[model samples]
Target chain A: MAGSNPGCGTTRTFKYQVRDQFGQVMLVYNMQLWDSIVTTSTNTCNLGGYNTTCAITNTGPCNVGTFADGTFNENLGICAPAGHLVSGGCITGCTTTADQTWNINGISLSGDVKNLSYQCDRSW
Target chain B: MYTLLLATLLLQPIWALPPPPSEQGLQVKLRANLENYTVAAETFPQALTKVAAQFEIPMGIEWIRTSATQREIRRSWRHTTVYGVVESLVKSQSGYDFAIANGVIHVFPKGALMDRSSFLNHRINKFEAKNEFAGVLSYRLRELLKRTISPPLPSSPALGTAGSIATGAGDRRITFRLVNASVRQILDKLSLATDFRIWIVTYPEDRTLTETGFRRVASLYTSSSVADNEQPVWAFLRWGDALPK
Candidate 1:
């Protein structure tokens, strides 16, 4: 690829070869393309137990994927994997406390703000 | 004597306007129907004024006196276009050029509109930017995104089997060595690199369900390669959206 991400940012295409028992190639896929919109942003949250009392107000349709696979848990207060990830980067809709800490996409909100460090232990 | 001649010449009006248009170049846009014009037994200027008054349109066409424009041309057609009258009169009166802009007509001598300065006098032109060629890249990327990301085809030497039953079929995955990999190969690599699903919906006409391999989708949207990357999809949506009119 020319760039780290080459080609138009449309759907990436895949090719497969179909063959009879003798293993000669067959048909090909006609790869057409289309459009999409996905923008993201980030913010700080007071992890006073970010999972519990810490109020991190981000817009909905967001996710905080802070796991090994970068997967996210929905309710930060729950502190458990809800199988969601940060597509939009703000703790998507996990506004447990109301404080107007920041604004995004022209929508203002109030929330507790703080930074926390994370450590991971090797499982395998 | 030279000073007197200079003063006399300086006193004359520069005659900023060109000599009155002789009948040659004429282009006119017919705004209203020809029947709407009331032909009169008068000078060309008077006839033009009558038509302008009847139509209630402000005098958009310039009124310049010339043998061609001033000639007492009579109405020939009972019903026709506004331009039809102008064209007819121009045909009747040789050596005149007629041009119309936004319902305003200016009949001048041939070659009158041809001013050497300004782009309007230059040839019409068209242009496209180098980046617009990104459309080609978009097309190529789309070509790559339509296949099973896995190497699905490789043949292993098989041993003759007993008549009872068959087992362990399709176990070998083919590793392809593409010399000049196509968009398909590039997309195949992308699918391997990412967790995105590249696919096309199949219709029964593509072949019976028993057929192996993807059938091109009938609908253009359903048939082409598409990706899950939301950002690129959005960019593709807005492609060529900002083209100048």
Candidate 2:
């Protein structure tokens, strides 16, 4: 996803991995950064053999899928297709973005990728 | 007479004994001089982050929801100890204090250290990692918490753990062994073991879990702005990246 600067302060786009309880990346989401204000783009994708789009608001939970057997097939990169469906838990994680500049008082110092990365969570 | 002597020895005040090595080491680090540090104006967390980066000290900050901590502060010190700098910073803001534990400088509210309900107070039976990325370690801790604590207590909220580390080659990793340690102690160990010596855990102003019943997950970052948020976030900092250019 692309982020627009709009010539205000600074804007950056970040790639976030939405992982399950086992640290498996279930889906990916892109975020637009405006200074400290962050907004998530609605992403629709095929995950775990289920076609679904997670409704992610600003720093909100991205309910990816509720698999029957509580497992996603690693080989197929989707949920196993042969189990009964069950209620799945919400996927939540930290939504804080990394800033490109560190402002101490009035001074601005450049920042790097090591500053911050996007994160999300999953439960088995 | 020997039994009486033994009884008297056992009755000696705890203060008479020397502090543990970790506490002593922390005390030394706190006494180290901070030369030529100045900030025109910044929030409490901002100033603390700057000082930790400049001094290359392992520091962790846990913030509570309060307006007193949100106010801006200003200070200029030509030469002063880290302890003095931290003391002044804590004094600049109300409803906060500092402590040295597991050889890390931790700043939090006065009673947070003893708050049993805090996630920091949760105990881990065993944690051993070798050359693990700091973010991965954080993920492991979250998994451990879910495995050990959540299933038995169905009413407890599931902790949403997230972390981001520097990708690509040359990323920093850590190795350590901890047995029967609290979440706070593990964080302190991470601070001392990696270049990401600075850690911060923030809380939402509402101080309530979502309707889904999950406590605000702590997000681990390599480096980031000290900006406060309405959501909970846990972040770490690399001293090298935070240095003044």
Candidate 3:
């Protein structure tokens, strides 16, 4: 399911576990700077699940939380506002290119493990 | 006869008592220096309103109004009417704050002191704008004393007098010349590098007769020492940057 595209009129579920170190979960819905949206939920848990039905309203270049509950199941479809191109890009930690980089507060992490080595990207 | 002598002895020197300052005394003293202040009054504008708004404590003349009643009229024709003016002064731990409580009318300081004084003195003295607004410096100093010392009301009471005239006619053209020439001259003296807007507010009504009861009329705004120009001018400038908000 790493690169699967879930079509319209369908719901997809991804099971995730949040580690104890970072107590917050953040899902980056889109990657465009001007049209970006990030949703944050909080709790300490190693296991959690989120099911998102994708349409023309919630397309994303997505990134999950850093630690516990950081895993996400992404359903992909054509979701773009007017004057925007529907697009998809993979993101992990805080890096745009590296799938395992964890960036927070403008500092980037180095280790592959969740919450270990991640970048701190606090620029808003 | 002994009782009468005793009463007289006990009543001695009441005549030597010092009298309190009278309202008539205040008015007489003020009028003697009336040549100094440019007295005018009208509905206050919003610039003054903003200054008054800053103060939780009121300062200067705030609420002013007039009323006529049947009972007052019955006593005397003048008694029927009254003009009530209220002023407030505030002392903040930071500094002094003053505001008038009037709903819309109040005293807000304009940054340009000398220019305001110049125009005001010209009004009071009825002079042809010799740039003598600085004359108000002495008058303002005098008012400081009045604010500190004078009693609130006068025994004689103030008799209000007002008149106005307008002109765009006749060979004299005195009104037009005075207004236009004075404004132009002042503007010319301002810093050339900077631009300024000028406005005139006349009392009673903007369209009132050329002669009117002016409590005061002044320039609404001004800046200091236009660029490099340094001339010893003082008036509104005396308050400096501590101008009322």
Largest lDDT belongs to which candidate?
Answer: 2
> Which segments of candidate 2 are over 4 A away from where they belong?
A1-124, B1-26, B34-36, B146-171, B209-233, B240-245
Better of 1 and 3 by lDDT: 1
Isolated chain B TM-score per model = 0.30, 0.69, 0.15
* lDDT value, residue B163 of candidate 3: 9
Task: Residues B96-215, candidate 1: write the lDDT tens digits.
Answer: 556643223444345534533211122212211121112223222332322122111346221110000000111111122334443323323222221111211112122211122222
Q: What range of 10 consecutive residues in model 2 chain B has the weakest lDDT sum? A: B1-10
The TM-score measured for candidate 2 stands at: 0.52
Residues B98-142 of candidate 2: C-alpha lDDT, one tens digit per residue = 887777888987787887656677778888876554444654565
lDDT tens digits by residue: candidate 3, A79-100: 1111121123212112111122
The DockQ-based order of candidates, best leading, equals: 2, 1, 3
TM-score on 0 to 1 scale for chain A of candidate 2: 0.22
**Which of 1 and 3 is the better model by DockQ?**
1
What DockQ, on C-alphas, does every prediction get?
Answer: 0.01, 0.02, 0.00
Model 3 residue B75 CA deviation (Å) reads 54
iRMS of each prediction in angstroms?
A: 37.8, 24.5, 44.6
Model 1: how far residue A77 lies from native, Å = 79
- CA lDDT of each candidate? 0.25, 0.45, 0.20
Q: Given candidate 2, what's the lDDT at residue A122?
A: 32
Docking level of model 3: incorrect
